[model samples]
Target chain A: MEFTLIKPLFGGFLLGLAALSLLFFNGRVAGVSGILGGFLSFKKHDTLWRFAFLAGLVTGGVLLLGTFPETLNFTLKSSPPAVMLAGLLVGIGTRIGSGCTSGHGVCGIGRLSQRSMIAVVVFLSSGIAAAVSIDLIFGGEI
Target chain B: MGLLMIFLSGVLFALGLGISGMTQPEKIVSFLNVVGEWDPSLIFVMLGASMTYLTGYGFILKRSKPILAESFSLPTRRDIDPPLVFGSLLFGLGWGLVGFCPGPALVALVTGYDSVLIFVLAMGFGMYFFEGIDSRFQRGVDGGAA
Candidate 1:
């Protein structure tokens, strides 16, 4: 497809705004992995905010689908097994790394955290390398 | 009131992911594929989010505590451990394989993509499994310290 700039840029602005809102009001970093992982270590008082945040996340997508379906593209290129394996790896890895794209990439980078900075560089580099390797193996199918 | 603000934040985050094309794996994969056709649009997403956070956090941190919460829950450890490096490497591999991170994957699941359910399930399992191992490791470390 053709390269388009506006949509992604605008979306980024919203993403930034979201992170800011979380920090400003809740004093919490808007990292998805951390939000989801907190339930595993469930504390009594901790459950409500996490659940609410997750519910809102799902609700947001549902609302967008109902209103502006064109805004999202639900395309899948990986097989079921591959996707599942990927999910498992992501889950374990993010927990071990202590953040995902949102945690490390967005919030971590925003705070200028040295640990986050290192994690971002390592993950981004590895991600790029893996993508290249996958492209080679799949013969550019992905 | 706290919960409501959090819920609203999640909605905003989800909308941003959807609008930024972060929900789409193909776009993510394209952005990652540096040697091949590279899509640099995601940089704007990172830039926008980071800039906003940079500014917002500046003001937010100046306060002694959050308006809604008792304190800010921020990552304090600065050390770069082995787990961080290896875990990040694995995370990258998986991200490249499916182009679905925790955030976008959840968003996609909500949008009626049944296939993403498998990924979510597997991810949950992965998280639990890691937790089990991590707790055990922590126990061993604590014992040694004692």
Candidate 2:
């Protein structure tokens, strides 16, 4: 019920627009893992757009930093090993799952894909479970 | 033209992540803390994105092809498989663990922090490793059962 939620709401709208733009223009799904993974492992002919997209993301970051530096005020809470393991898991898991939050939660759900729905459910469940378990065992926000 | 559009899309996506607080790992971690002081802002994020995209998708599907492409490249698989379930579960676990999915992690890479840099490198390695293993399994190089 807090007004702070407005920021995420507005940002979410932009994220959706971003996905819609890709769908409308390129006939592609704007899945971050898919884009980056393909860029890392796919053939050369399809790499250009992926590269350009990532470059654009970096450019956006620069623009945001220059305009509103206060948006990025949080810090990493996990340790080095935890971070590495999580990254590895996320990279492989997203590739195997065929999507992530953006792909499944936003685009897939918006398009009414059953597979994406199931994937989103699984993602939320596991995410909450891991978070709770970590908190219970680690006894803090790790 | 298509490439430029994709670039712009990425820009928008990153800006959205930044604005929505999705780029902040701790914010996400807080959201995951459902038993504690749960932050429901991420819920609004998904809601806002879903509504926006759903409306656009409704209109976009009316067309045969996209503006710059011949066909809509969408996921066609409808069946539920072990990989899909387990993979999503694993991805969610990782997301909970690190609070950095592929997109925000990329955005966070701009911070030039050692943690973000290391995570990105490891993630890249993980993706490459999956490709290597999957391809070998496809070709029966390591006797990997299909």
Q: Which runs in model 2 stand beyond 4 Å of their true positions?
A: A1-3, B139-146
lDDT of 1 by residue, B99-146 (tens): 889988888787567668998889888988877888888821110000
User: Compared with the true structure, what per-residue lDDT tens digits does model 1 show for residues A51-116?
Assistant: 888888898888777766765665777778888889998998888888889988888888898778
lDDT against true structure, model 2: 0.82
* Candidate 1, superposed: residue stretches over 4 Å from native: B139-146
Query: Residue-wise lDDT of candidate 2 within A1-142, one digit each (tens)?
Result: 2339689999999999999998899878888888887788777687898898889888888877887676666678788898899899898888788788888888888878888889889988898888888888897556
TM-score of each: 0.93, 0.94
